[model samples]
Target: LVTVNLTANTDLNSAEEFEQLVIRESGGAVVRLKDVADVVLGAEDYDSEVRFSGQKAVFMGIWVLPNANALDVLSGVRTELEEINRDLPAGLEGGIGYDSTVYIRDSIDEVLKTLAETLLIVVAVIFLFMGSLRAVVVPIAAIPLSIIGAFFLMQMAGFTVNLLTLLAIVLCVGIVVDDAIVMVENIERHLSEGMKPFDAAIKGARELVGPVISMTITLAVVYAPIGFQGGLTGALFREFAFTLAGAVLVSGIVALTVSPVMCAKMLKPGMEDHGFARLVNRGFSRLRDIYGRALDAVLAARPAAYFVWAVIALLCIPMFRMSPSELAPSEDQGIIFGIVDAPANATVEETARYAEAANDIFFSEPETDFSFQLTQPSSGFSGMRLKPWSERERTPNEILPGLAAKLDRIAGISVRAVTPPSLPGGGNFPVEFIIASTAEPEQILEIARTLQQKAAASGMFAFPPIIDTKIDQPEAEFLIDRDMVASLGLNLRQVGEDISAMVGGNYVNRFNIGGRSYKVIPQIQRAGRLNPDQLESIYVTGPDGRLMPLGAVATMKQSAQPRSLNRFQQLNAVKLSGVAIRPL
Candidate 1:
């Protein structure tokens, strides 16, 4: 229901406001967007995302409501967006476009009609060979019942009536009834040889049932692996397997139960066999005679046949040299892309601005599709994710080059931009590393430098040097003497409380407006707040109710600290990861 570009730039506050406004205006029918989906705002996601020629870019896609008609809802959404685009903010302009998944079912339905026509042609061929319309009717009657049975089972199993599954059923339209036709034909053959209709119906099926059942079971067993062994592709293909299994199983049962009963009543006396089957039977009978004679001729010339076999084996050796071995299938999922990046030590506001700038191009042209940014992924250094979409526009492979040219013009970037890669599953990467450590910051800088050198020397990863490293941020590190604080009659907790009030501030409660809540923040006035050099001058109350200068027992100076710290297995550590292409 909700998706994001890994590198999009929309203000988190603004995206939150827009989401809340929509939910509020809907009169709570769509009560909790976050409950049903993750309405995250951040940079576009990159796992399975595309980048414009290694520049940050993103594309988004939306799934239609389960119960709603896709075309109707999408059309209404398009209309609403067109109206909204008339009043965009300055230097901000974009247009919405369409994607085929919105209307693909309708197209599939059109294809199904052609498939149905082909099926009818196949049925007509069956009648022509049997020389009786009754033969065609016998098998065709099982088609609808078989299809209905599949639908009922799919519904019971909580499966959506999707294209991949339906294509299997469409494919069965011609083949499903073939077994019944064969059983009925064999019964007609028995009748021509002077057997009673009831006896022929029963005996003919009794003779053929073993082979018919074995063939049907073979098909079901072949397709059975899809249901058990498949991974993500299995989820898509399993339904096809099950649907075909169901149709084949149902048609087999119908062939044994219904087709025989129908044959007894419908098949006429003295019906003639004609068409390709008749020609096949006669020609094949003569070919058997020819083959027997040829076998004797070949046995007498066995030396020449062995010479031909040796020559063919010699030719096949070179074929192995031309064959390719692959580890995984190459992917091509339309043309859209996604991207997520962050500037060095960027505040959330600055990150949002960069993301919005990147998102601007995605939303600019009318032909451009959809764009998304996870503007506020989470608190504490989590940047945004952006994704954009296009319809008639070029694919990610085509547009990335041009998009890279455009993004290079932007300033203040910390990482070399990269495009999203194609993936089988449409999703964003979850792991993002922000390298920070507490070893005097300068020591941490050295650690990062060593890591980059080692990784580059490994000759496995081809990306640019690790770039999250940066100059340490200035902080006030105070060393308070324990005995001096006791002499002042002030405990450490009291000093901590006073410092928290002066710096970290306090959260005052909330105000409710029309059932909505907003946080109220309280803090010292900006001009009165303590800076690193001014920390020494700040005064704190002692236990005897006397004012004492903070400089007396605690020394303060400008020192560096990491923006964040990470722990691995309860020990401080730094994490680094990136995509690996063809490795040495």
Candidate 2:
């Protein structure tokens, strides 16, 4: 037997000491660890990797704080990026990998376009129906005035103009015009009854005050429930609901206060003698006569009318019960979100390979503008930003099923393709159920597997549900032989320490350089420890300080272990999450 003496404790402070470590001394010409492997200092693991626009790039996610404006935050990020781009080192650069705010800005532009179109349409419709520029002008003036008042109320309530509030403003155009139109028509009627324009305006406003108040109350109440709703609905719609209600209330007040004066100034005696007015008045007269006769017939059949009204009222319940419900409707946000789930034993590099396969599928689509990815050891999230809505013939919703099918075909991985949520704080998957128990996590994992298998058999999901927690990580255990170790004149402690030092990747201590501390770790290079079979070649110091193969006294046994264990509510819990094939 050969003996190698340990004289003093050695502290490896740099790569050179680790490289010069002695694995064994076979002859007068010594053998060293460097003969079989290389030593290097680097990160413990490359767990976080990002790919942007199909190129290797870094990714950073920015989340908005509560009560903060997302657009403003995005703007600041963009400005900072410009400065960062300027200072970037040669041939290296940084910028936004993907911005969710792109969709928000695009949607805002579409809503603004719709707002302008609605304004033009409103003006055209009023001109066609009333057949008087003067009548159209009066109501058109009220539209802007009421909107101004609504803006004031919104400011007072600490509301900002957003997508939903902009939509409320678009809708308010019609409601504000409604009050003005009513005032104009009623005044014209009084004028035709042989009153002066000034007298008719005053009389019409006084007579319709009650009707206008009731109209305002009814329209305002329609959106009151949405604003008062308890959770997500209320939070999302409070601005929309109150904006609309406040606009209508302002329109009513404006009509009672300002529209009557404008009507008097713009009206004249027998304005119906002008364009389309005479024909419209004639048509209305005939329709009114017919309506009078129909009313008399309905009064004669009061019993049947009562029965018909009651039947219609009862039909609402069944219609409502049969309707499908969901938290929010699907929208084409111009991007597709994807989730990559690899085997529990998979490494970062393995998962990245799977992610690449999925990314190719995403990038292959005709509408794809760019693709981005964030990778982890066993799971990741990725996405593709599509071209503009006007540019793409198919929306993200239309393309999702086929894309998902293609992603599922990738070997050795599960890829889920979905559209991003239209609203904040919404679930990414359509189906999610939590299973909690006081039993051990292993027990809960078994129960979760059964549920997932049953769910897959039922064909409810686009694919089988994925459990959040898994007990499937691979492990390597050395089955040390106590008798053999004793026969070799070695104890288990020496063998264990030798194995741990060589492959455990534990840091021995720290060394300082350039005012910063770096961990000093000594381990067999990655190439030497690539697989469990290589562990047999590792040498440990025996009781007499002679080097011997670890295989002589210990054997490695392969097994599986839990990837993670989590506790929820003081109980082990597992979540089953999936995107359903059909809306549930």
Candidate 3:
């Protein structure tokens, strides 16, 4: 059993910590993480693509674990925050956000408050124009019926009640009541002139219906273009278009159908006069009086007005140039990552150990939450996984860099660095280029060295610890004399078993405790696998039933070679990777 305890200064991300916790609980029986690999502390390798309000921030997505309920986990996370908030680190605060569904449900209460406020505003506007109880009540009735009807339509059209939709509702404060205003004002004027209430209402509504319907249709058409934009922009604004269009249409219908009926019921001959009504009437009379005066002055100064208009138009042209175009506004969600590689021929166990140490660095610093995952290259003569993948830690910023440095110490691993991920619709970094060549490794190395020098002198990248090229490996030989083995009545297969047993170690059955199982690996006693002298000193059974020394059948020699090599177009190549401080 391998035990890993994280301590301060261990800088690690949430992903790495999650990975380590998984390793500790699994007990290596289902699979020995170590047998497969090592663990260590390192820097944040992945870049955070998004930023919030110009400050660098990353998203740490949280999902309910299997067999766990979302709301329950959400509650737990909230509790964790309360605990953390009691003593938060400087410059940081924790907040939670939900998906669209939950957001709408929570915001619906606020929408009701807005709805009430809108009603109050519409009442004030009506009192300003028409000045009586009959006038104020008519337009106010149109607001709720229009909105409720809009809500039903939005539901049918699959729209969520969100910011844009709510904005559309707010916009309706002026628009939806206009038709009601026109109908009510016309009928009241007829009543003042001594017409019967019912007759005045019918005549007024008939006179205004054409213009009201035309205006509503025109406004709806103006917003129709938004629905066709497509993708993210269209998806966001579609609800606004839908709700606003529905509200206006409903308001128009109510003006024609319901307003006339209500006016007939409410209007009466010689109704009681009130002080507020007189004030409203006097205000409109003054407005018309002022407008007549302004009209005469504007006509006399038409040339000056035109000159001012031209100047304003010229000023607006320059202002347009200052506006910025972007895909979307950025948001902050704190997150971090740790990337590292291990030494050649290093066992999985060692790799996991290295990762755990890195995780310790993160937990110690108490950065954001973190998690990690590990993958390995396939077994082969090339000593490279066709994938050449890795294990990574997802953590908060406080622990990321320190964690990355810890992983860099592992064997066979190189080119470890921390970087933020690319932005949406933007190119991502850490992209590797496998430059293949027919030239020898020496030549490849030389070319790599030159490229590195050019890159360094160019001042194009600001990140430190840049490595231009990496050699695959040092070469070695395993000599087996088939003839000598056959003469002794021995087989090559047996020799392979002896070597495999001596090195790879055989796996027996498993042992279980607390419902968890671990694999039992049996290894032959060996002085050292890397020492040729020790290989010669080992013993194996021969065909003659006599123990034969390994030295009698083979010779060992050293040579330079790559543990892993990649090719492009049948040419030998090595990959060069590094973080660019400024995005290219």
Candidate 4:
């Protein structure tokens, strides 16, 4: 088969050029594609729309790889955004409207601020408790050393500096301080007891060495199980547990190795003879007397202690059983998502109006900083980014119920406000129960409805379960008569293609605008195809190039059918989704 190429140009960059596409040529009467169809460029799906703060908008999201750092990835994206925004055309703007990393950054900043304030408070408290600058210095040295060592341990464990790990660091401040302060007070006590600085230091260090080791081991043992346990709990808290355990171990080491040495060098005879030291000493002695008396009284009634301990132990099981349990406690991520359920047959415009109502409900809360909405023909979603955590006292979870109440008042649309998943991988809804079987879709749907009703009756869900595999969408089927089509000398393929061209919204070819290739989809005007009656006006090619109305070859059948055919693992599936009133 030999072929000769006449024109090298295959890229039709405009509708005018595509309209000149050759269809047929006979007796010098060439028929172009424009004669049979209209070529226009438009959005891929007219049913999907997005808005930011009530304006048409497009969004782009940047995600970090699992092994990569989120902060670093967002840092790079933010830098790139600056350049992109600088080059945007007039009357247009581009920037990050939403960033999950902002909450993380703010959380980290808040933790650091608290850490600084705590350190200052720790210094003052230690001075007042000991009435000795020497004691304060020893702890100041030991605390940082322990924390830095904990950071080293984190590095060895390949743990990132995250919320949980930082929280461990903060908690270590108290644990490490206890070990350091105990060692300091022991050496200081020796100094006041008339022991020489060097001898007191050695004796104090040796005396408490066993106690320090025991304390460190006890602390480490408490967190060790948490680090090694199975499941999401272990994964989330492994770094936290290990970091805290490491910090305690490091604090123990520092207390024995550094605190004693510093105490020997810094402490001197008559150090506690000062007036302030005597006053503080007197107050502690009286407090110690009161504690000693209380202890003696408790010991005098020995059976009471045993009875109290027995009662406490017996209460543990019931208390634990009755406690509210959730995957994780709700957190303030500064955003709330409003899920919008539109009628199955609602148009995109109708969905948009529903979404606007949802957005209004979201913004009705004074804490809302900004709002966004997205809509499709059958569903919609909206979100409100609350003010910064510092500005808003209530977390997103706290505000969700109120917003949901307001949203419930909107007629027709069902809007459910939800906080971001407390834990990762929870998906959009709390309850995503799926019913799958090899049975027919109708059977699966019936089973699903039964389950959904049961779930609603249990009073566990915030709303009635919404089944996904609903057979309620109205459809108009074009029932073609193959016999009539054949007798009319009409090609079945041409007939189907002609009908598809008129209303299918399928792309035929690509046209370029600037350097971008756009799809050329030829569909009847929206006004002309608004109902089933409009389908009759569409024409198809017949014998001898005659144009025949589609109504002559096909009949319209109105029926209710499933909006979609859903399968899971090759089994018919129906998903019932809802929010749980109680935590799962």
Indicate the worst ten consecutive residues by lDDT in candidate 4: 422-431
Select the stronger candidate by TM-score from 2 and 3: 2
Which stretches of model 4 miss by more than 4 angstroms? 1-10, 20-38, 390-398, 436-439, 450-460, 489-491, 565-572, 581-584
TM-score result, candidate 3: 0.51
Instruction: Please give the lDDT score for candidate 1.
Output: 0.61
The candidate that achieves the highest TM-score relative to the unseen native structure? 4
Least well predicted 10-residue stretch by lDDT in candidate 1 = 377-386
lDDT of 3 by residue, 1-584 (tens): 99999678453233344234333234444543444334333222321122222223334558666566555567777898799867988887665422322333445556768867877877886776666776678888888788888888888987766667887888776788888888887888888888899999988988897898898899888886787788767866778887888888889999999888998899775442556777777777899999999999998999999999999999998887777644443212233434455445545445544544544444544332333334232111100001101122333233434545554554444324353442323223353445678998668867766776777676655333233345544445668887888878888888777776665555444544356554444344433654545776666777566678787776667665655566668887766655543334
What local distance difference test score does each model get?
A: 0.61, 0.85, 0.61, 0.85
Cα misplacement distance, residue 561 of candidate 2 (Å):
2.2
List model 2 lDDT by residue over 206-240, tens digit each.
99999999999999999877999988889999999
lDDT of 4 at 173: 86
Candidate 1 lDDT, 1-584, residue by residue in tens: 88976876433343345345333225446554343334333332212332232233333556776577666766787787777768877754444333444335454675678778867787777766555677677888778867777787788766666666678788777767878888987998898898888888999999998988997898778776787655666765788888778778777878888889998888765654455545645665698999999999999999999999899999898886766633333232333333445533345556556555665655543444444444321111111122333335444445544665565555633222333443334333212344554455456657767777776677544343443434465567778888999886779988876666555645445544456564444344445653566766777777686667777878875665665655545545555544333322
CA displacement after TM-score superposition, residue 290 of candidate 3 (Å): 1.3
Total backbone collisions, model 1: 50
Please give each candidate's TM-score. Answer: 0.58, 0.87, 0.51, 0.91
Clashing pairs in 2: none
What's the distance in Å from true for residue 61, model 1? 14
